[model samples]
Target: MSERKKSLITTINNQRKYSQVAKAAVLSSAMLARKNSSSRGAPGSAAPFGARESIAAISDMLSTQHKKPVRSSYVESDRVEWALKIACTISMITVCLHTPRTIELFPPLTYIILAADFISVSVFMLDSVLRIHYEGIFRCDSSYLSNRWSQFSVFISIIHLLSFLLHCYQLIGKLHFSEISLILLFSDKFFPFLHLNYRVWYGVIRSIRPFIIIRLIPLIVKFKLPKNRIEQLLKRSSQQVKNVTLFFVFFMTLYAIFGIQLFGRMDYHCVQPKTDPNNVTIMDLAIPDTMCAPEGIGGYECPNPMVCMQLNLNAKGEGFYGMFNDFGASVFTVYLAASEEGWVYVLYDCMDSLPSYLAFLYFCTLIFFLAWLVKNVFIAVITETFAEIRVQFSEMWQKKEVTLDEGFRKKLEKTDDGWRLIRLDGEVEAEGPKQKLQWVSSL
Candidate 1:
């Protein structure tokens, strides 16, 4: 019985040793397979590199290879950027002040103003180029030529260059105190079409410089939260505002067309009385020109011994007096009435000219629809958009606060004395009150 027990034990021990060796062999084979899979794509391997990683590596290499190096101190300095900003402000002010009439009136200071414009434009062009080079090329990983900001910089640079050239051309004329021979030669030879209107083109180009004030938007946003909020509000409400504008314009145009058809050639004024001085008798005044109404037909009469004159018929000479003579004038009249600005006099004039009292109904309907209904709709749209933005901002602020509180809780720990605030690096920062600890623990 003892011998049989010994044999059984020996057999069991031998089987256990064999199972252990098999397990060791399986683990070693698994480790070798993992090592081989890891080192599959070496320098002398038949397999190629991973497609995704290869493309990423190539893209990184190319981006680093193509990026331009910044060499100019002026392009890198913050002071230079501020200086350019000041120049832009001065340029805007100069553009506002230096009109054609200003140049003609202040002939003695023309050269001085021209010099300032030249300097400002040069600075603008240089700054635009440097911005493209530094911010678009040196700082960006993408190609500068394809960058949108670089494209905008290029366009602005072209405008500044054109403005500078126009300024130089004007300076040449100013230097001669008239159109110089060189200018005439160029104008006649190269730009005969623009010769007469050279000043007009120059004025147009110089006027564009004032739009550089758009650059100050960033500075305004940095300093004022109200401006940023206004920007956000405008962005969010742009589509609604566009719809409202379209509605207003469509109704305004419809009313204008109706006014033109209803009140066309009807606004008559009595002027230039041709009375006989010797005869003291008041004879009936015959309508000389186009009459507003037939003789004693609509109770409309010429009060004075004057000729009937259509004041609104003339295209020029009479300014706003010609309100509803043509399509353009009719549009202006309807727009004015819709805005409720000086519409009472217009209504009375229409009443005197027309054969009936339909003008009252027309103007009342226009004012009610546009001024009351459409204007209120626009206001409501803007108010709703503003409210939505305010709520979104409040929610974002609450989320930020909650995140901060959670992070603080994560960095807190209980100690023997109280609750200690531990940093991310496992260092104790501060100890807090037991109540505060309990509050944080509750969270």
Candidate 2:
């Protein structure tokens, strides 16, 4: 459509939205007033206009059903800005936690989380910078440059603190910052050299493990952050981050492979006494073996039907037959089953023993049913919950209403896109917890 046509359409819709909202609000207030009046046994309860008021109130409530939240201070301040900060922090931390670490004994799979963190941080940082650079912070009673701590919110103040510390930290370290680098943490000042927004650097600060996981309120706030038009931007960012992250994972995998080979050939075996843990230890060789199990369980006596340890390889490795087209289920199932880090694996742990998609659908049915029952039959679709949250928060923060809380579309898109994202949503659907009863009845 032409710009003029689009503008007209928008104007009409916005006008309609305002009217609907006003009518609904009026009705809700009228009923609430009537209920209070009746409960208090006020003389007005018997008034002739009482029925008329109630009827009008009902009409208003019905009219307001489809209306959106008003762009008031209550909704804007409490909703939009806060959600943005919280969501950005959460996204950053989630990404960072799954990413690989430079140090051993740290969670091995944290790199995936770290990759996600980088993208999340950059977007949030952009928002923070935008707020700092463009918002009417100057109009407030406090000075922007002077008394930096005055009249700031826990959320905004936290973002500011994180951005400053991280940016300074990055500049401090002479070494280059990788996605997982703790050094180039977050930014405080807007980068004059790179022209990057300082606010985005705040997201990096959010990834600080102590801030996210250790601080419960901050963690919850981070998860509840809002997004804007940058969802598509985030999608693209997620892909870029994942690709870069995968490259690192590949490198690490190769490194592990080499480490395995080096450790494997160390000639540290004691055939005489096999039961001792310290005798001829070899951790490196065990990695690949752990990753890729035996070919056929080698016809050895089975230890357990379900356990991977039961699988064994043939003792003898002769010339020709060793090169079978298939090495059995070991390299595939057992290795794959054992390979995923516990955190990664837990996602699928409660799923049905079926293919991922069906299992996912089953999971969704289960969670929805549970959450619905718990919420007293008020089934707030994920979209609606988020929409309400965004509206409420925007008012709380006293910020401009964000454009990204198109709740239904965003949630639906998340559900329909990529396998992993889909799996997550599918898991949220309604699967009744009464399956065991059904089985019992059938039996």
Candidate 3:
């Protein structure tokens, strides 16, 4: 082997030498690793045997099967999750960008990616169950259920588990040619709509768009952090949510004001003016005016239309809804795409607009979904960093470690350099006075 190849093996081997686990991995994969030659190709090329995976498969037994530590590194779990997730993300990007406009290549690759996702979901299932088993719901000291890790794990695990199962059902069904078209029709997002409760269904149908769900892994794993770290993270996330909420409220308040001031007043027409003989407009849908109808029956009888400014069409250049309009017709005839003509059509009532009442529901759902993404997905990442910060703060607070014989107060003295607390000998230096006493409430 060349010097570079030797160096890489040396580095990988050296890194693995710390833990017995790593040592086993290096030894087991040694022959497999040696086959590579830089002259032939890249050092870390794709595994000739199969797709590359550095993390060992979860299907392999975990020797230390004791309850996972509360503040665990989850080094293996995180590594595996990250490895597969990155692969899934890359493959998705590849299919979208370079893969040809063909049926066979797409489905096979899609199945592989989805299968990888299935494995990830399975890992989550195992993790959640293990966490629950380790951290029992009911504690002897406190009758109340535990808050640290397992509960949150169960909650997130259930959501993703259900998602995985539903996706799996669709995947299996799609393998059959007859179900392929239907699966293609409904797979990406409609499952959520179909599964949504009655209260949430309208919101799902009107504004739901397919989202790539790669960013949710770390989020579900967060509550497993140590108490101080969890508290600190929660504190930061809560603040962020508050700030975001305030910004959204202000933005939307302005948006609403702009809509009211800038939008023109309307002469009411029928809900479907061309289709319905009975005259009914949005105003009629809201108020049963004598002018709108002599009989008081506008809201009860008016038809509800789900309309969008249709852009980004499919292969046939069509929208998501199947029966919304006739396919192959003038695509722009019924649907608008924010063009001047489309805007004019909406104004003239040629292009239908969705009910304003439904928009609020969609808007609220979007806000919650975005908030969840930001808080759970984005904020969870800061836990480890937060933990590191906590460690620093803690060390700074505890100037010296107090031995059992020493005054338990951990003596504090205010001096020129600010309040300093003495720590135990050979421990860390205390940077500030001892904290005021606070009693813990019974759990």
User: By TM-score, who's the top model here?
Assistant: 1
lDDT of each residue in 1-443, candidate 3, tens digit only: 69999999999766655454533343334323324332357666644522111111111112323234545535236675565465435434433432224425565665654565466557666755554455455755222145533355455445545554554554555455665545555654567655422232322221211122334445344432334444655676677657666754454444344333322222233333333323323442323221111124221223345211122223342223211232222232222211223333233231123333443443344345443443454455456556655653453234213211232324444679875544335366545444222222322
TM-score of model 3 vs. true structure = 0.32
For candidate 2, give the lDDT.
0.39
Query: How do all models score by TM-score?
Result: 0.61, 0.21, 0.32
lDDT of candidate 1 over 1-443, digit per residue (tens): 99999999999989967755543343333333334655775656633323322232223333344345756666657776676677777677776767768867887666676677677667767876666665575454554556654566556557767776776665665454455745666676887776642456546766556566666555344432233344656787898989999999888888888888777666455555653323212242244322344355462556555655434234443346536677788888887877777888777667667755677778878898888999899999989987977654553344334433323333334689775444454545456697579889999
Q: What is the lDDT for 347 in model 3?
A: 31
- When sorted by lDDT, best at the front, the candidate numbers are 1, 3, 2
Q: What is the lDDT of candidate 1?
A: 0.61
Cα displacement (Å) at residue 407, model 2: 32
Q: Write the per-residue lDDT of candidate 2 for residues 1-443, one digit (tens) a residue.
A: 69999999999989978866655444444445545556788674554545443443344335445555543443235454565556556654564453224323564344444344455455445544555554345665432333343223335435535544554443344344554233233331333455333333344544544443332354254533333323433564556556555643443344334323322211121122223323323432232222222334222121232122321223231112111113332122222322332323322321211234533543344334322332332233334545645544543344221211211112212234432111224445444768667777999
Q: After superposition, how far is residue 68 of candidate 1 from its true place, in Å?
A: 18
| Candidate 2: residue 169 Cα off by (Å) | 4.6
Please tell me which model should have the higher TM-score, number 2 or number 3.
3
Model with the higher lDDT, candidate 1 or 2: 1
